[model samples]
Target: MAQKIIGMLGGMSWKSSAEYYRLVNEGVRDRLGGLHSAQCLMWSFDFDDIAVLQREDRWNDAADLMVEAAQRLERGGADFLIICTNTMHKAYDRLRAAVDLPLLHIADPTAERIKADGHKRVGLLGTAFTMEQDFYKGRLADLHGLDVIVPDATDRATVHRIIYDELVQGKVEAASRDAYRAVIGRLVAAGAEAIILGCTEIMLLVGPEDSPVPLYDTTGLHAAAAVELALG
Candidate 1:
């Protein structure tokens, strides 16, 4: 079978986008063996401009940018689209409306993983918008029948701050890791069966060891799912 070309709409921060590229290529090689790599096209953005729109509450503007990128990927011969960042998924509906290609939403695979593991309740750690808004958590609850929990307001701020201020820039501090561990601990205490590193960048800061329960890395799951679709 001919491999489908995966369309990657990324660079909400290039750090996580790089991980997606590596993981997709590695997945293809591991499955198809020796020298095989993902058939993919990437349209990376200048996230600084995207961030400015986000901060200014110009979501429509941000969505416009996403639409433009997705359209570019479609024209470039991509069979489907994957938006690499969790937060940017807030604009998902708009992008979907604007593009003709199928979109592999980042949340669906993560929710499936959690359910497959027999987890009904999971904690999410991501940018403030993902946690506070309905776009992501609502999708888990509405579409997947999963109970999603997030840290308290204070911890949410900490998570959001570290994402934009540190992780996105490729800075990973032990102190930030420790802070995340503490947040994960609290979420577990609050009856979280597992933790979802909902932000792509959060996986860079914390992992399974930091949480008492299982840790789901959205970035990894999303990439693997893309590979499955591309090669299936």
Candidate 2:
């Protein structure tokens, strides 16, 4: 059997999408020897438009846009799909229904790692939409049986602002990093055993060394999973 082609719908910020591309191809190369990389197709979106729809609570429209993107990937001969953003997965059902190709959920790989590590509770850090919404936390709790904690309202606002104003723009500041550590501290105080870097762009700001507990980089995990599926 031929290796499956991985399809990604990304560029929600381009910051994390760039990481996904590098990680996916790197994973393939590491496993398959020199010169081998993922046979991948990517559909990058305009983050400006998606952000406007999200800000206005027009997820139906956002979902419609993703569905169209997924169809294009499918037509381009993609065997499986990856949404590439945690917040965007809010439209998972709609996007999945519109395409026949298997769509990998970013949460699944994170949950799998958490479960394997015997962590019953975890903290989640991501965009306000991903943190505040049930699409992500609910999936971890309901589907994977993990307790999830998010930053409080104030901290959530700080995190969200840092993501858009700093991280997505490719700017990393010491103060912003400190702010993230403080929020992670709060989650740790709330009994979180591990932390999920739910936003792909988040790993840029906070990483394993920054956290007291184990840090799960969702982008790396998701990309690794895509490589596994592609190789098989």
Best by TM-score: 1
Please give, for residues 1-232, the per-residue lDDT of candidate 1 as tens digits. Answer: 5899999998989999999999999999999997899999999999999999999999999999999989999999999999999999998999888988899999999999899999999999999999999999999999999999999999999999999999999999999999999999999999999999999998888877888899999999999999999999
Clashes of 2: 0
What is each predicted model's overall lDDT from 0 to 1?
0.94, 0.92
TM-scores across all candidates?
0.99, 0.98
Where is model 1 more than 4 Å wrong at Cα? none
Q: What is the lDDT of residue 148 in candidate 2?
A: 91
Clashes of each: 0, 0
In TM-score terms, candidate 2 sits at 0.98
Which one wins on lDDT? Answer: 1
Which residue segments of model 2 deviate by more than 4 Å?
none
